[model samples]
Target chain A: MAVQEAKRANRLKSGKLVNKLVNEYWEDLINAKKTGKKVVYTTGLPIGPFMAAQDMAWIHGEGYGARVAARHEEKEPQTFAENKGFNRELCSYARTQMGCAMFAELGVPDDLNPGPIATEIPAPDAIVTCYPGCSTGPQWDWAIERVFGKKIPWFNVVIPYHMGRNGSTYMKGEEFEENVKYVVRQFEDLIKFLEVVSGKPYNWDKFQELMGVTKKVGKLRMEAMELCKAKPAPASFFDWSIQIAPVNYLTAWPGTVEAMQAVKDEVQERLDNGVSAVPNEKYRIFWEGIMNWNKLGWMADKFASYDATVVAGRYTHMAFWHEPDTIDPEHPLRGIAINHLECQLNLGYPITEERMMTLSKDYSIDGIVFHGARTCRSFSRSHFLLAENLNKKMGIQSTSFEGDMVDDSFYKEELVNTRIEALIESLEAQKSRG
Target chain B: MTSKSDRSSFYTMGVDSGSLTGKAVIIDGNRQIVSHSVKQLGFVSQKAVMMAIDDALEKAGLALEDITYTVSTGYGRKRLEIAGKNLTEISCHAKGANYLYPEVKTVIDIGGQDSKVIAVDPSGNVKNFAMNDKCAAGTGQFLEVLARALDVELTEIGALSLQSDADIKISSMCTTFAESEVISLVAEGHTTVDILSGMHKAISGRMKGLVGRVGMQQPVMMTGGGAKNIGLVKALEKTLGVSIFIPDEPQIIGALGAALFANDFATGIRKKVEEEQDLDKSRVPAKDCASCSVQNFQLNKN
Candidate 1:
């Protein structure tokens, strides 16, 4: 048969709202210095509630890196950092973060900076980082600290290693309790630091209330993703990836509750109307690892051409949904500590493998796509082992491609296309055999 | 291979439009390859694809209209407007290699610009595969470049490599760097055989890593242009610790696989037609000849 025309994935109405909020957030970030609002730089931890409680404007470094990549403007910042003696092998997101800081410090022209936005990032009064088993996250923060000559207050939250041998066990007994206490102590210290920076007393009630909002958003997000368990998924992982800004960057904001509700409602309406994200969906796939920001649209179309829909991705579902109900608003800091400790990245591969198996069965996934981002070793590990176990243990097929999350140059269109098509062909052959 | 009882006059064609060349294979209903042609691709002219097709048709003494179906494969498979369907090279290679050697559990294909190792199941489905991306480190183009740098014919490098006794190592992992390394080896007075041996070893080492991704199985078959290089095949066999198998014309295996798929398509259509005819016979009354004729007419019209 002739190859069908590639169609873009259907966008949700809520996605437009997310785009607006994200733009507004960017404007607020840019104007933070002038408005005397406290701005903070943070990593990809679920600390948005804390920042929101403090009424602070925050720039999520990883999120900003994704925006720069999606805009197809990562090359300049990446090269700029490389010229400053940063190894090209470092994480592209880290490189971009460092490059932007260097550019701002060096008084580089706005046009030369080539960020997702034209404006320079407002200098943060404090930076909150974490050690969640991802070295790149903390290393980038330290590098940026050195770049700015220690002018900013840096607070690092040490999230202990929670996974046991073979990734099969979580820390148990006294060790688990001690780990939570350790992180909670750090959170208390961080609160003190934030209070000093904001020049106000810490509000326990406000923090508790924001934590409640975060829990609601996480539960709603998980419910919407659960709706994808339908045969013809209403929203693909690609659509979900696009709408993550609110949950990741604006979690405690009241607008996020509405944003996530709209997302859930839109998905429900599609299910009611018998709409499919991929028309005549032939296959359901689970994507593993970070999104290739540069190829999001292109990859969506490629999968759609084969009538395959990527229904679930562990990374895209990374809202506050890592055991959302476990977080109690009454004791917010300890719950946040548990939430941080339970992150998928901090959990070992055996745990990831188990989750993938569950995802395959739950989503009726016919295959898995393992995207090994060149720089993100955190997610790149054990892909081969996972693919083997999934195939041997569960009889699910899989395929893999190597590319960077942000660096477009690392992605080869023809190579990735061939691998995807080959996967579809193999799936079809297996179906015929049955 | 198909039995003689399965033989028929119906013909199908498979075209493989690759990076450096285009190939076409024609097969009969018996799944027997009748004729094939290969043509080199040129920058401004993709006529190689059509030319290969015409040549194969001419040799088979058939016209384009006589062919029941056409399936195209390889890098340029989609660009073939006349193909009934296009498939990835991974599937095609596995199908073709399995057809050649029914026991083949894996296929290692080294093309001009890229190389792939495909794991095949017992039923001839692609189990898994891995390929080198955006690199010419272990491909036909890499060998072609080094052969020119050594002032030797492409056809002679393989046999020459076999004659070498001293073990030389080509340390560079890139094709361009390897060429410069080869030139420097010549300046250092290394024999042509030794340098060729080093190049073969380097290419085989790279192929080993690609094969490792899919977990190589026994009864391995090697295809594509690189399969023509005897030294590379020997080196691969040694590196992978398994005996390798090669087809009579390894480069056309993808086209042959496409031809097999075309035959399957034509067979499906023939079966459906026969089934409809049987249904029509069953629906009509035996005594009512005139009514039967009318029903048959309506069925054909629909």
Candidate 2:
């Protein structure tokens, strides 16, 4: 018998643009820190445009995670953090960041040589952050306060939930308007912290201009996601995982928009020619919950084995969808506030399930693969309920397996393969019955 | 271990090669258990699987070819080349549990490395399931480690655990951590029975949380090698506040389910072939009448 090589994902023009843009920003972050230019390592913040206006460098926490995870370089940092008080139960990205911090103390692992995302990740002069209804808040707080063995100026931007107070768990109806006002106030305060850290007064024009760019990116994201509705999507969500760099870190950059446009065009080309991301795409699957980042390539190949493609996912498109009308540059901070407010993580469990159902219908998804990520309590907690509801209401087939965002030890590949293969069988059976 | 054969007429086999044990069940066309074997799994799961298969085959007075269809399941199911097909232990366990107790809507399988709770639909298909695979703290492997720590035989620990009169607790929630805790408890002069009782309760507490994840729909059937531990069963019963049912041969449930699947798969293939033959009979001359007749006879018997 002859040997057969695994088929590799085509490197699209958009993918190259995204990598170049992300790598350049990361290199600039390192250079900015070395040259005495203030660089901010942050979680989800509404200040990218503000930082871009000055010499300040901004690195998104999730963007850092994607880079390290891409190279299969998260293990050492993850272990370093786990050895410390930070449990594996914290978000995988958070732990990796913590582990990356210990490179000086725990010493850098030979493999890391401290790569673009991790080893070279400078200690944040300040970490601009907010909860946005996920585990990122506490993890970000830890990233600033304790990860470096000393506290730094950390902006804990409090975004109101349902009732526009600190406590409401669900996103409510009328409070959404007031909730935006409250979150904008927090963003305004976050700008104050940014001013103090950068020693320069905040600029409204820069902020508004960045918001306009962000709105464009958001619009493009919303539009590109609609393409998955095609029978065989032009790209899988795993491919979209690469887009997180441009989406999360370089949000308002023109190159990011250009990159996204290139993606949209390529996908259109694929649809025109009746091409698919997964060859002979027999099953269209919608993935829910956080990613199995370390095993992403393996998971994608596994889907290919069954001729299944993860056409859409909650993560790649984000949990919430908004249009141009939703993002107003005049009230930029307010619009950014509302964006986080409507984020999938902030919404209550019931709303998330409803969104999952909508996506299932929109994508014509035959199955759902919920990654029962160990660290992400909020998302992992609702999988069973979400799956049960989707099964009961939509008659959709769903399956879940335990995984960690970047930790390899948390999941067994064979176990995941069997569960997915089993799900495929169940989906086939369901279709046959219909 | 190979059990004495109750009968010698068996034509179908089910092999469950798990993380730690390889179990095989041989059933006749009537689905009666003719022979079964349970062997400790080794590094080479294939060898262990073959060992179990050959034992069952020997006890049933049969050769490998004599078995019509072999369905392999469990963790090592895919590794076995001898099996005609394979199914996940979740589906197989549900099917196996349903065969033993048809009303069973839940299956709590505490296997060597992981503990799983599955909700079974009326047709024996799994509705939803939760697993505690990442941690060995609440599984058979946990008990094995604790048994070694206590210097007690695993089989005896269960019976001895029931004899314990003292109330004891295992503080650590991790298997390795609990081993150290067990050492300290022993240094403090806890009896083997008391420590074993605590171990069972610790496992029960963990299993209880896992069962809650899937939600309980009883009557719950407990299978796998862990089901053989009476003390763990009692502990689970107490924690869950419900009576749990165990099959006569709990360890072979997975293999039994695979056997049932094999029987069904073989039967389905035969029916399809016969239907094709019937279609051929009308459109063209039958080229292979002898083979068709043999398959036709097989279909009729099924």
Candidate with best lDDT: 1
Q: CAPRI band of model 2?
A: incorrect
DockQ (model 1, Cα): 0.40
* Pairs of residues at least 3 apart in sequence or in different chains that clash in candidate 2: A114-A119
Question: Per-residue lDDT of B255-302 in model 1, one digit per residue for the tens?
Answer: 999998888888888788878777776563345565454533333434
True lDDT of residue A141, candidate 2: 61
* Residue pairs with clashing backbones, model 1: none
Residue lDDT tens for model 2, A328-396:
887776667666777766666666676778788999998888888787776677777777678778877
Residue A357 shift from truth in candidate 2, angstroms: 4.2
**Cα-based RMSD of the predictions, in order?**
4.3, 6.3
**DockQ (CA atoms), all models:** 0.40, 0.15
Each model's iRMS: 2.8, 6.7
